[model samples]
Structures are given as structure tokens and as C-alpha cells.
Target: MYPTDFIERINSLKKELETKTPLRIEDEKRLKKKLRLEFNYNSNHLEGNTLTYGQTELLLLHDKSTGDVKLSDIEEMKAHDVALSQIEEMARENERPLTESFICELNKLILVRPFWKEATDFNGNTTRKKIEIGKYKSTPNSVRLRNGEIHEYASVEATPAMMTDLIDWYRENEPSMHPVQLAALFHYKFVCIHPFDDGNGRVSRLIMNYILLKNNYPPIIIKSADKENYLTSLQKADTGKQLAIIEYVEQQAIWSLELSLKAANGEDLEEKGDIDKEIELLKREKLSKTTNFKSKNTVYDLINHLHDDLWNSISLQLLKFKDFYEKANNEIILNHELDQKLSLTIRDNFNLFKILAPAIKIAIKDNHLDSTDNFYDIKNLLWIWSYSSNKTATKDIEETIEMNLQLEFKFYEISLVNNKYELERNGSLISTTIIYQSKNDYDTRITSESINNILKSISKQLIKQIKEEE
Candidate 1:
């Protein structure tokens, strides 16, 4: 018996898939219209460009008989157009780009009119023979396997029985797995089955996405750059090393989710602030001379402040901090009011960070002095305050405070010492003693300067040792 929730589930999955894939606006509108007509065939308005219940069955039969070919050449051009339009529309809506390979696959599915027998690779080579197996031969169209072994791809001659069984298994089992893990497994199984010799990869990917889309997860694009890694993970999956595949898929899913959000906001992933570039430039220009400079503390402090500001700004821009209260160890509460407040604070902080980072970096580079002591001191104070049990700050508040402190520290340490300033300039007199002196009869002194000086002196001596060795 057909599953009771099959139609509802399919619709839900379709909606999700549509969201991730890009579609021409016109195609999207047409698809909606067509789907409406298809789903509401009994309505009186189903006279023109609409399939009756009987006609729908006929269409299905035709599609199956033609080996699941997409209709594009029926006498009723409107109907044919609608069907092809819906397919293209669905593909585009899911933001699935139609590369040449994809187009070739689509052509293979053109049941109404068979066009090309095979798709050509980059070198224009076509696969013409069927794949040979132990006792059974399968389609020759197959992806490269990692162990330098190739098998007959399975999907091409997949029976309706097999498809039905697989679909049932997916419906029953997928809910138990994490969405990312499920997506990966589903993709692997679908591809391994090689259901459609000609368009198995594309269909398998589409089906994998269907499951994820149904679950409200984003689509993952295995980029050409990471194709090898992606294939390697698949190979691991085939060998029963499921964990590797799962991790790879999870990472890809997270990346895709982040990218989706960024794309929606019309932001480029590669965009970095001018301040970072300037800091890099300064490091390249000043490192050699500063490497030998004494009193390198000033440069270090300046660099730290700049680095902190840059990262602070970037985080502020990307994250939506929700107001959360610690209930106990790791437990927290989230409510609407807190969420709004935290979000606003996050946005404001991000803007502030962006505006201040470049200015701070520029100032440090120009001033060439240790003007960041106050900044570091304030940050340390905030860090102590936020993490203290006595403090009643929200999690968002604590995180923000901690982030600011770390940024300041990192900026100072990385930029000044490594990039622009050296410790040998000030007479190489690296050591000093902070002494508290009283009347000489029986005097006592408290000093930390000695410790600080010792560290500096040691650092300088090490650099000298390295220099001498060179």
C-alpha cells in the first residue's frame, strides 16, 4: 500500500529543494501554475493546459514506458512545455546549475525525442559500451572510484521494484539519522545503485537533496576544487568506513549553510577588510628592522589592538547573538525579548568593530608606539568580570567581552613582534628590575620588573643565538 503521508512528504521535500536551487523567475511562476493544475485536476478549470485524473495516469505511464524520459515533443506543445518547464523549473529552483554534463544527462532523459546517446567529457570522448560485471553487465557510465577500480554503474536499469524498495527504506530509516549524515548516506546509496545508467549521478544527487530538502536542510555543492576529497569520502563510504563519509558530509553541509546565508545577504565569502591588508603590508615592510629593535613592546601592543578590532568586527557582522541565561552548567534559556536584544547588540558590535579595526591598525602603524596598554588592561578587566561567578551577565554578554579581550591580546602578540618590531634596538638592555626602596637601615623591596626583564632578555638572547648560527 502507498504510504499515507507520501504526497504531503513529497510536497514538503519539493518546496525545500526549490528554495536552495536557483530558478529563472519566469520559470518559477510557470512551475507553480503547472503544479497547481496537476494537483487540482478535478477542478472545473482543468479544461485547458490541465491534466485530468485519467490524463495524469497516462502521462505517468508514458514517462515510465519511455524510461523516465522528460516529455518535450508532444503534439500538445503546451502540455509538453509545462512538463519540461516544470523539470527545468524544479532543477533551477533548487539552485542546481546546469553544467554541460548536467545538460547532457537531461538530454539522455528526453523520452519524447531521443537526441544524444552519450555525454562527452572535456576531451570529447564518449562512453559507448555497457559496463561488464561478474555475471551481469551494467551501464558503462560510471564515476572514477578511489581504489583505482571501476564497476558497472547500477542506476541505469533499476527496476521500479528496486526504486520502490529504496524509497521505502529512506522513509523508514532517514529520520533516525542526523540530517547531514542521512544526506551523505542517501547520496552514496543512490549513486552506488546506479539506477539510471545515463543520468544516475544527477538523479542520485537530486534524490539525496530531496531527502535533505524534506528535512529543511540546505543543499551542498561538492565544488570542483574539492571533488577529489568528495570522491575519497565516497570511496570510504563504499568500504564501510561510514564515519569519514559522515564527517565529510557534515562539514560540507555546514559550509553550504553558511554560504547560503552569505549568498542571501549578497556578501562575498572572500571579502576582507582593508585594515587586514594594511597590517600585512606593514609586517612585510617593517619586520626586518623591528626584529633587532629594542623596546619592541610598543609595536606589539599596537599590533594586538588592531588584530583584535578586525576579528571583533567580522564576528559582529556574521553572528546573531541571542540573549541566553545560564540555568546550570551548559544549559541556557532563550526567549523572544532576549533574542531581539542580543541580535541588536551583536549588529551594533559588529559595525563598531569594522569601523574601529582599520583606524586602530592605521594609528598603530603610523604612531609606532605602545599606546595599547590601556586597551589591553580594559579587556583583561572585562574578561575577568564576564567569567566570574559573581557576575550576572548573559552568555552573549560574556562571550562578547571575552572575544574583545582575546582580540586585543592576539593583535598585540602576532602583529608587533612577528611583523613590525624587534627587541634589540634599545641598547639590547632587555632586563630590568622593578624595585621598591625604603630607608636604608633595614630596607626591603618588591619587584616584578626583574621577571619581565628576564623574559625579554631571554627572548633577545635567543634571537641573537639564531642570528649567530645563521
Candidate 2:
């Protein structure tokens, strides 16, 4: 279905991406999550879901959401996450060709629980209809156009055979068709077939992305903001003008590629800093494109120091179990991808001393950390931590020790940031962070020695907990 020019463009971009096929696995993961959030937000928004981009990011990344939105919107947002996970898992684990069952499973996942809806029956009276989850629609489904015309999907009887034909067609043409063309055409055809009663559009988008992902192509986001254009392009396809939609898909693919390349090169994945104020108290910092800012030098330096300190504490904590690492010979690898949230205003306003947290992972060799009771094949343990700048608000410092055993224990709020140092029942357990200005007596008095002692105590407790759990 692709024209000569579209084919050439797709092929050239494909070849360019092929040269960079093996992106750093960490970058690949970060980019994948980034695209997933964008795709889910845009796709759901297209279907009249109200969650904003910021809300979507928070919900997906941190499982924390803030908005005046409906509960169905929240459920569907979460369901979309589960559905995306299902699609990726299928892509990774399923060896067989795409099947009717797989598509149905995707529908089921995106709508975790189904609810009944009122639709006009064949007799022209309203009836309560049970929208089946993970099954083909038994009732007639159609769409009414803006011009008061009706567009009907394949009959309920025809849905099964049409879906089978669609899958068969995909298998037959996938090898020869360019992926952009394959994905776009499949989306159009699937929408035309309208196999499901409720989630046809959503499932079609998912299937389209699945095709692109399976073919090693980056997923294209049909942005909801461009809804009019998307619908118009689909209409063009309905008129047997396939090149317009194919070209539209081609452009989105190109955008996806450009986005991936930018992210791979360590550019700011999102906009940072408030540019509203023309004149600042300090000059806007000129930053190198590589590290993004000169302040990153300071941040990285602090990160190195912090990493060493935390590593030392962990080492002392595990010193008695030297056999764990020595006899087992479990190597500890340091990955330097610090997840620093680059902010210009913070750097400009003050000497930004701390960075957003990154992590360190210690490989658990064989069954070294496994216990017979839990039978947990502990793969690798990790420590996630960061320091504070307190630029926006009083930063809450926390650290977590997580392993595949599903054991997570932490001393959350024992801080050097001018707070009470009382060691209570849980050794200064601060479940909820208290945010305010540091008291006069508590300010600027926290010393390295105090921090060292706290870490030492936390390490001992952590070690004790591990032993007890084992």
C-alpha cells in the first residue's frame, strides 16, 4: 500500500535505526517506559479518557495520582497499563503467530472488568446489553457519522471469520510489506471490521503497535490532539485512498525515530525550568549538550561520594557474611546511570548540591541469598537513594533495600536535615515525611559523624532483618 517515496523513507530510517539497533539496554528501557506513557496517554485521550499527561506519568511511574477525574478513568488508565504489559509479554514469550485468542486477551486486559450498556436493539428499542470481555461481540455494532449516515461493521456471524482472515492476511503479507504500511493498513482494516463492541479502536491501536514492535520498529503514537486529522486520514483510506494514511503513519514513525535518537543521546526527555522570568537573580547557566549542564559535574561528583559512602556502609553490614561474596564470589557491578532530574532553576537559584536518586544493584549469585522457607530465587538486590537540595521544599531523604525475595525494609526519615534524631521503637521510624523549615537549633548542625552513625545503625538493622527473614 506504500508509495515509492514512502517506501524509500521508511527503508532509509529502518536502515539508520538498524545501525543503532543495539542501543544501550538501560537507555532502551528508559525510552521504552517513556514511549509507553506517551502512547497510553495519547491513545486513551483519543478515546475520550480525561487523564492528563502529567497525571498519567505520575500514576504509571510512581503509582501516585492527583486529579479531579472519574474512577472509571483511573481504572481504565490502570487497565491500559496492564494491557500494554500483556502485549509486551506476548511479544516476548509467545512464539506462535498472532491469533484470535491473543487479540481477545488484549481486549480483556484493557477492560479488566466489563459493565453492561444500553444500546438500541434490532427491534429499535433500547435494551441492556452485556458487553462481553475477551469475547467476540454477539450483538450488532455500528457507528453513526457526523452527516447522519451509518457505518456498520461485520455482522456478529462474520466477525469470527473476518478476524481469522485478518490474521491470515497479516501473516501472508507481513514478510513483504513495510512495517509502517503493514501497521497502518491493519489498523484501518481492523477498525472497519469492528470485531469488539466497546474497545475496537483501542485494540486496533494496540494491534498496530504490536505489529510495529514485533518487526523491531518503534511504536507510533497517533496523538489525540490530532484527532481530526487521524479521522480524516482514516476516511481517506475508506475511500480507497490508502497512501494518505500510509504517509501519515510514515511521518509518525519518523517522529518516533527522532524522539528515540534524541533520548538515546541523553537529551532532556522533557522540558525543564521556568523560563517565565526574563531576568533571574543569577545568570542562566550555559550548559554543554553532552552532560546537559555544568552543574551535572557537581551532581555526579556528589553522587560518586554518596555511592562510596553507601557502599562502605553496606560492606561493613555484610562483613560477617564475607563468605557470601567471597566463597560465593558474587561480583558487584556498578552502573553509573544516575537518574538525575536536570533542573536549571535549581542550579541557577542556589548551589545545587544533591541530585535525584539513582541506584546500585548487587548480583546475588546462585541461591546465595535464598532461604528454604521463602524459596525465593533472589536474583539481585538494589539500594535506591539520593541526597537533598531542598530547592522546592524540604526534601525527604529515604533509602530502600529491595531484593527478589520481596523483602523491603528501610529506615525512612532518619535525616541530617535538621530534624529530631530520637530513636524510637523502630529506631526513629518516620512513616510519613514532615515538611517545614529547619528549626533554628537543628539547622546546619548535622555533621558527617552523625550521618555515619545513622548509616551504621541502619546497616546493622538491615543486616539483622535480612538474617531474621532468612
Candidate 3:
């Protein structure tokens, strides 16, 4: 047994499994649906699929689509969901002793409608190829390492025999090996074989979960946020250093069990410390470095004045601005009514800015506004205000506020380099100008026209820079 809390948790989970008290119908349906969606989303995301969690939820839950993602991505997400349901059904129906035929069926189900792909051959020459759905590879397959050396897998002729040996080994070891170890080892061996021409990673992951599910364990998810660690672990496994991958998957499995235990007890899923914890951690770290700007103008006063001006500006009419709250992308929108209240809150509690900054950063990052390559037209983004208190200010005076306010526009250059998202510094722009009440600072009079013009300027340069990089 590993010397970790997760191993202890696994032992506890073993006891829970012994309960044999089946989950409530509502809990069963809810947990299964949530796990299916999360598993499909995270697994596909690891393979560089571009569907957002929001898009995945919309598509899988409501048959709705958002954003300008590719059709192939959409189709694959749907197919992956179908495959998940099939696997869960198999687990629930007492299907055991998984075989090559069953694995192949899953592979076929995942890539339900496989198509041709243009890929480089083993010799580094590009060629058009057909990816056989649900079948073994017809040609040799290997991966090029970071050092430009190819790591070849078993020959096409040897793949079938290797897979058979793998299954036989699995069957023989099942009785003695812990289910987690069995699943992890199988996942490692299957990935090393690279059985199919495509969808090998996704299929291997599916098989790993199948092993766990068949053993009355919850499915483990490899989140995309840990993509780098996951890949590095796999690479290490290739070098006979399997501990990293083993521990990583075990931690994920522990997390899965935690969620399952909670759900079975009628607990709210949000209590799980995952995506929310990440957001909070990121906020704490990123906001700590924010510089404070001192000024005589209070945040409340400044925001109130700007709000009234923009509220009655002709430029708002020219820009077809709405009278109330509306969604807008990169283009910044300001609502005096809302801003007044938010500004006051920040004024009273400066530390609250830490929370706000991370919220804005997440919104920008998740929406892909930072990367020009993935920018979404956020049609209605209201002004995001951040502030801090001045120790120099007398205790309760409103004008003595030390709120450092700015409309920050940070642009990032992204390239689809080698079919991967790479950040480039060629045309990256970072603008942070503090808003002040100095009479000479004409920029203080924020208007819809000025905001729109600024977006146009930044986007134009962004587009040109991206084109040049391409």
C-alpha cells in the first residue's frame, strides 16, 4: 500500500463498497449523469479537444451549443458521451471479464464516424491516411519526443498479439492485484501499445475507468488543468519511472471517491474542492501583486460621475448601447447604478478587491479573451472595479478613498504552433492606466465611443499581429 492519505481513503472506500446498500435512485441517476459528463469532458480535453465546460454541459444536458467551436469537436463530444453511457450501462448490468472485442467496440463507439487524417509517417513525411474506426492500426504508429526522436510502438503485425497478451495478463492478475493497480498498469500498457491509429489515449482512459467501474469503484478523471503533469507522468512511465503517473491517477481516483461518497449521502456537489479551489488559489496569488494607486478622488465619487455622464452620452446612442444591463465582449460597458453600489463596497472593504480581480481574470481567461486566437465576442462586459484603502486617509471620509481604478486591457498572442496552443510575445500588449480626476487627463471622461474605439484599435493590431505570426 502506498504511504499516502489517498491509500487510506481507498481502504475506507473498500469498506463503503462492502455496504452493498445500493445508491438511492435519484442519487444513482444524478451521480451517473454528472460523472459521465465530467469524464467525457476532461478526457477529451486532455487530447486537445476545444469544447469548453459550458459548451459541453449545454450540449450534453440541453442539446444546446454556444461559441464558435468546430463541428468535429462537437460531434466527438457527443460521441464520447454516448460511449460513457454505454460503459456505465455495462458496469450496471454486471458485465465482467472485459475482452479485446469489448474494448474495440468502445473504440468504435468513441470515434463513431471516423474520417481521414493527414499525418506524418514514421519517417517524418506527411501523408493522407484513413483512420479505421473501431479497428487496430493498419500502419506503424509512433510519437516524436521533444528531442526530435521517434519512440516507435509495436509493429502493426505485432499489435494484435501484444494486445492479446495484455488481456491475458490482465485476466491472470485480476485476482491478486488491487483494482487501482490493475487499472493503472493496464492504462500504461495500453498507451504503450498505441493500439488504434487514432483515439488511443481516449480509449486507454476509457478502459481504465471500465476496470474501476466493474470493481464497484467510481471513475477517475484526468482534468485538463493538469495536462502538463499528466503528460509528464506518462513520459516518465515510458522510462520505467511509473510512480509519478501511479500517484497522479490515484489522487484523481481519491477525488472521484470523495465526490461519490458525498453524492450518495445527498450532499451538494459544490462542496467538493476542485474547480472552485483552483479559482480561489489563483485569485489569492495573482491579486497579491496588484499595485495600489493613491488619489484624492473616491472610487464612489469617480464612478458616480462617470456613470451619469455615460448614462446620458450621445455616444451611447451612436454605439447602440442599451439602457440596462446587457452582455458585451472585449468592449467594456459601465453601469452607474451597479457601479455605485460595487464601488461603495470596495471603498469600505479594500481587501474585497482581491476577490474581484480573480473573478475578472478567470472570466477573461476562460472566455479566451486574453488569447487573440481564441477571443470570444463578449457582447456585454460591465466595468470591473478594483480598489484599496489608504492608511493616510482619515478614518471615515468618503473623499479620502485610495481606490486604484483602471480599465485594464491585456492582450496575448497565441499561435497554433505544431497543432498546439503556443504563447508568443510578438504582438502581446499590456495596458494599465489608472483613472484619476486630474483636469488635464482627458482620458478620465470614459465614454462608450472612447471604449469602443479603444477596442477597435487593440483588436486591429491584435488581428494584424496574429496574421503575421501565422
lDDT values for all models: 0.38, 0.59, 0.60
lDDT of 1 by residue, 1-470 (tens): 12222324434544554565674455444433433323223111121323333334334333211111112211222233343443435544644532324423332442222222444443648633432211122433555455666554554455444555666666677557555566677678766665553434444544455455555555554543465687678777777886766667666566555544444444544323435634643543345233422223423432343234333332332223212222111111111212211111212422433344344445434543234443223222111001111123321212111221212322211111111112235323323222111221000111124323433543453344334322
lDDT (Cα, tens digit) per residue for candidate 3, span 128-159: 68799989999888887777878898889999
Colliding pairs, model 2: none
- Candidate 2 lDDT for residue 43: 89
Candidate 2 to truth, TM: 0.56
- Model 1 bad stretches (over 4 Å): 1-147, 155-160, 263-470
Clashing pairs in 3: 327-379, 327-380, 328-378, 328-379, 328-380, 328-381, 329-378, 329-379
In candidate 2 the C-alpha lDDT for residue 166 amounts to 94
Please provide, for model 2 over 1-470, each residue's C-alpha lDDT reduced to its tens digit, 9 standing for 90 to 100.
Answer: 45646667677777877887688888788788878987998889999898777667666876654323444566688888888777766666547678899899889888765655669876768767778889999888987776777778899999999999999999999889877899988998899899987888899999888888887778889988788888888888888998878888888888787777766776655534223211221122121112222132222322233344434343344344333221111112222223211111112111111221122211111322222322122112233222222222232322232111111111111222212211233335344222111221100122335435655665565445335332
Weakest 10 consecutive residues, lDDT, candidate 1?
A: 381-390
Candidate 3 off by > 4 Å: 1-5, 17-21, 271-470
Evaluated at residue 195, the lDDT of candidate 3 is 88
